[model samples]
Target: MAPSKGRGGRRRPARPHAHYARHGPQPGLSRLHRAPPPDDAERLHHVGPPVPHPTAHRDPADLCRGQLGAEWHPDFHPREDELVMRQHWSSSGFANTDLDFMLKQHHIRKILLIGMRANTCVDTTARFGQELGYHVTLIRDAIASFSWEEMTATFELNAPLYAHAILTTDEFVDIVNDGAGKGSP
Candidate 1:
């Protein structure tokens, strides 16, 4: 685990119970929210930068904040064993999403992240989880980016810095089928 503030307000490396929670929306947050984002006092407090109506999807909540309801969710949702979270308030899922708390409650330490935005939101969430003492894994092909370069940069450079293992979808399936991943997620 990471360190925490000592008497002089200096953090020592690897503090046990005192491990600090380095999370939140970043500075200006609208721009710099990542890796223990700025404190509430230092972070942006505005509702938003003001976006236009949802032209792509019928549910504006999927694209904008302060709009919440079932309509914001996709058609695949409301299915069995599926979880529908509110609009992401920050780049790091653990920052405001209660994911870490939920994981720890279930005694889950390893995480497999698969989603869009390989470099931005996915990387931020992985790094934040790694810093908080979770074993993070990124599936290479399961994630995507706007460009090949972004995907390459994340899995090739940034992911190595934090992720415990970088596997492909096939490899993940093999692990599951081989009984190596039977009891966990």
Candidate 2:
């Protein structure tokens, strides 16, 4: 989904590289946001003027290097020039992150989604992106859920409703690398 003029006349990025959102520092562990301490943890950097949902629930996405810090595993550290937006909400990455900004800055309109929270984070992000007129694609093999039924429901039943295209990682790679559809890879 590179540099394509997608639905609503929005343009997708020429490259697939995107800012990491909802990639961990998972809230399931009950950690805190990265800055401003846990008491008033309601701010998003690089997220544009007036952070959405000012009166948000109390849940920060990081706690420094604490045992229960809201931080991604060391293996998932952000690469140079990369941004990792911490989602304040459990389901949608757009809730408290700069995902929208990154997408717009890079002219991304076609969203390719993958990750572990197929039924939750992935599902919510995809649905919301579609609502905002982004062409959403789900990489089936790249996503998972807490349960097999959840995975099936996400990719098989519910995804058809919002996802513009659904493909296995291999199929997508084929399209990008080979010629399933050019301009990728």
Candidate 3:
């Protein structure tokens, strides 16, 4: 939580809340608009083995080696040092997972989010990250929404307010390199 503005306009940290508020008491169709992702499901409507689109099958795992537990990229990139590129459904980001411990170990101060489905897991994780005090930047190119409209609308209504919607991978890499972005080791 951010602190109240002082008479001099100095900023301060807000006292931690005893508990975070739920978006709403119950999920409605609008809830689907912000639903969490399903990681264990054996299906991906667009990108996994089930997709009919040829290019869509380009293995996400191959492009995302860090999340797959592979060696870091040879580029010696700085974002590679701090930014975590993870599948929303993977055990990596779950509450009980080692992610929190890993972040602490690495002294991560902020998170720049990049992945699929802006409305589901992406949204949930961003919300969770904010509650935990990690600034999240949702890379627009890196993320693929379930639908054009959903993605467009989400970016329109939420991205500016909740997280930054960066337009390219290059910009994201630059931020991480500059240390403006940080996350788990």
| TM-score for each model | 0.57, 0.59, 0.45
Window of ten residues with lowest summed lDDT in model 3: 44-53
Instruction: Summarize candidate 3's per-residue lDDT along 68-184 as a digit string, tens digits.
Output: 323432222223124443333421243444454555555654555544445655666666766776656665544555465656555555565666343344444453445432431
Q: Which sequence of candidate numbers ranks them by TM-score, best first?
A: 2, 1, 3
Residue pair clashes in candidate 3:
3-14, 39-89
Per-residue lDDT of candidate 1, residues 1-185 (tens digit) = 33344446633222111111122211221221111211221222111211322323566556655444223223112334333344344466665565666566556677666555667777988899899998887755555556656765786568879988776545555555565345423
What is the RMSD, in Å, between candidate 3 and the native fold over all Cα? 16.4
Q: Please identify model 3 stretches exceeding 4 Å from their true place.
A: 1-92, 164-167, 174-185
Q: Which candidate should be chosen as best, given TM-score against the real structure?
A: 2
- On the 0 to 100 scale, the lDDT of residue 135 in model 3 is 58
Q: Could you tell me which residue pairs clash in candidate 2?
A: 32-60, 32-62, 33-60, 33-61, 33-62, 63-70
Kindly report which residue pairs in candidate 1 clash with one another.
26-33
